[model samples]
Target: MENEVNTAGRPGSFRFIHAADLHIDSPLRGLSRYAGAPVERLRNATRRALENLVDLALAERVQFVLLAGDLYDRDWPDFHTGLFFREQMVRLGRADIAVFIVQGNHDAQGTITRELPLPAHVKVFSSRSAETVHLAALGVAIHGRSFPQREVPEDFVPQYPDALPGQFNIGMLHTSLTGAAGHDTYAPTDIATLKTRGYDYWALGHVHARAVECESPRVVFPGNLQGRHANETGPKGCELVTQSGGQMEARFVPLDVVRWHQLTVALDGVESLAQATQTISVALAEAVVGAGDRLHALRVHLTGRTPLHTTEAQQPGTLEAAVHAAAQDVAGAELWIEQVHLQLASPIDRARLAQGDDAVAELLRLVDELAADPAALVAWSSKACGDVLHKLPAEAKAETDWSDLQALRELLADAEATLLARLGGAV
Candidate 1:
């Protein structure tokens, strides 16, 4: 619990919670993107995470909660999901913590969530135009706008009130703000424009990475409360905002229930299965350091060329089982080994394989070459299969892999580690 000061030079703190990208019904993307992960937990983690956020708001004694946008995934299965969301809102309302939100592209008018009756304390900004909600009691004025139909490329910040008289003006927005990586450029607004709006704090959304973009008048992305995939690593949560004596301060609070996990173990010249399995076990333990004692689920990626690859490739199922067994060895462990990606290669020299005339070798070479090509690489992915034709009841089948984000991140980390270790002579 830290003191929050407003810019007006007032005394005593006004505490509030800032959260965004709840995506209430977001289908756990990565867990089911393949097989082996705890499917039920993955599917339901979003709901649990939202509950966690509610708990956080109450614990922090926040007078209000700001939901920047995308409260639920568009067209969430049925009314039950919406009902569950309302239940959490009810808890916040009981605590007298009002919530303010704006719609994002995910839950636009065309989606199924357009009919939910949010709690009385929750206020959704007008989608047709910018509006302001003056909280005179708290000496705060919140200004914001929502997406009318979904696709809004125009900057929406310009429409916000320049500044409110005798109140801590907060601008709540759901935007891609100046083009964010891994996010669509929706409702783009420049940093300078947002700064000039004269709001004491600018709460932003659409990017899963938590950031403090500015300090003079704090602009922040609280990030998603839950991690949906391995790409969204590290702590995830909402930002707690409080203003005291006219100074406003915001702090990030972690709230993820079932964390999306990533564990990488490199094999340089290992040849024995026992040695490799032991190394993997140690790596998994290290990664789970701060995860606490929970029903942990992991996505393990076995990288770097190793002599174990030939055996690992021939019996993928066996390797997967072995890793699961190792994870299960931990006491009271409910850990599930989701998938073990074998990016390993044999210690045997590539020149030997190229020189050989084995038909399997030649086919492997051709397949590898195709995998290296940009267009061809995408065509070979499962996403491409769904894109080439129509599949009923799964409209999102055409979603582009765009970049194999997890793979790219792992590759880059490996490259950096190699260069650093070599340059410093520490390898």
Candidate 2:
């Protein structure tokens, strides 16, 4: 029940829950690679998380719940999933809280939800076209539509109704809004379009990070009810929107039952293994706290320069094991440490490596040359590497000097050594 109140207002203030990106029935990947850590725990955790959202709504006595989209993970083959969803909807209905949902790219037309009969309290907006639902009794009007196809290339905002007069109008949509990293640019719409629509509040979905795009005429993302992967880090849940006299405000409420975590431990200028381990311990503790109520998975990234870099190069698994052991020792912690990625650099004497008859130096030189040619670098992976490379933060993709290249090359060699000698003899 981590309530992230972002707005200043009184209680019982026309409250409703704005939640989205419930990728329900999504496969819980990469959790508990080690024994005694059951994946079922994580699967049930997501369901429990949804229940927690309902509980939150009931506790707050919200007037309604706005599920912008992605309620299911595409079409579930079995009815059990749909049944589970029905039960959740019934719970909300029992609380007399209405639920409004639209279809996302994942659950477009012809999906399982199309056939499932939701509770009377649940309102699934039509994919055939945009529509508005006016709750005159509540003095609220909601405008939205569902994804008609799996991919939407045009702006869907134009399909939304212009704000109704004298009503607290909210537009519920599952759109990329503007383009977002690591996601398809579906239902593309801009802030200006939403603003121009004259809607008092925009309950948006499809991106899994909670954000307040604007305050006045409020455009907000409630993020996801649960974090499904490593890329989705930190607090996740719905927004609590409260309105008064056609004016609106919103707050974040974290409802994640389990969290995905990544901790980057920088090791610049470190002296010893003890020092590095100590730093890693502090970082692990910090990651757990940052995960809020439910952080079950973790990936530790060891970055920067240090004496431990050499030690990690020689026997990386020992260091990884120690870190895992440390995380495991935390009481009642479901922390599953998957891997300790080495992004570190040893003190490099570049001229010495390059000048001498060192095989490592030659490898370093080649990698440096390859890294220099942006065109050649793009050929390594099948993805839109150029697009991805261009999108990287300037600081990460910044040009490097010979010494930096030497460090990067060594880092690559060290990674191979770590995988082969320390992680396993597989690489």
TM-score per model over all chains: 0.81, 0.81
Off by over 4 Å in 2: 1-13, 30-38, 245-247, 269-271, 290-292, 329-334, 357-412, 415-427
lDDT by residue for model 2 (1-427), tens: 3333333221224789888888777876434444555577667766777888999999999999998888788678778777888899998999899999898888777655447778888998998888999888877888889988788898888877888776778898888877888778999988888888887788899888887787766788888888876778877888876665434556677888878788888889887766666777777777786555565677788778665656766765666766776675565456777557777665656456656565655655655666675554434322424566567666555542323544444444564344333533221
Candidate 1 overall lDDT versus native: 0.73
lDDT of each: 0.73, 0.73
lDDT of 1 by residue, 337-422 (tens): 76677566555555555455775346446555555675655554445444444543343444534367455433433333333233
Instruction: Report the Cα lDDT for residue 290, model 2.
Output: 50
lDDT of 1 at 221: 90
| Cα lDDT for residue 335, candidate 2 | 79
In candidate 1, how many Å is residue 183 off?
Answer: 1.1
